[model samples]
Target: EPEVTQTPSHQVTQMGQEVILRCVPISNHLYFYWYRQILGQKVEFLVSFYNNEISEKSEIFDDQFSVERPDGSNFTLKIRSTKLEDSAMYFCASTNTRDRDTFGSGTRLTVV
Candidate 1:
């Protein structure tokens, strides 16, 4: 089965620095998204992108976060400035239709 793929499986960063999380969604998928789970906390929605524009975003996706589809297959989330609270497992998901979404294993971000 095809799946969304995330790179750097894990990343260690310093506070106040920038970090880019990368993902490659399934070839045929049309919608892509980013979500994060802060350790034991529930998974929180960050942003969604479709047709090369942001379809929707949550409050957590403030000035600190941005999403982009640099090419046809790659989707990226950039954190302009990292914070301790930003440390989490960030997941990438994609789907061609609302009923079927595939998620990557996730990239774990550790802020030190």
Candidate 2:
């Protein structure tokens, strides 16, 4: 079965630094999304992308955060500046239909 893949399974960064997490979703899937789970917290939706544009975003996806599909197969999440609170497990997910989603093993971002 096709699944989402995330690189650098874990990352550690200094505060105020920039970090980009990468993902490649199932080829046939259309909807893409980024969600994050703070340690001990529930997963929260960050942003959703479709047709190469942002379809929806939550308050957490502020100016400092951005998502892009530089190439048809790669989806990326960039945090312009890291903060202590930014440490979390970020998940990449994609789905062909609205009913189900396949999530990548998260990229754990740790801001020091």
Model 1, 3-109: lDDT tens per residue?
78999899999999999999999998999999999999999999999999999999999999999899888999999879999999999999999767999999999
For model 2, what is the alpha-carbon lDDT of residue 53? 99
lDDT by residue for model 2 (1-112), tens: 7789998799999999999999999999999999999999999999999999999999999999999999899999999989999999999999999768999999999999
lDDT of 2 at 103: 98
lDDT of 1: 0.95
lDDT of 2 at 48: 99
lDDT of 2 at 45: 99
lDDT value, residue 105 of candidate 2: 99
For each candidate in the order shown, give its overall lDDT on alpha carbons: 0.95, 0.96
TM-score of each predicted structure versus truth: 0.98, 0.98
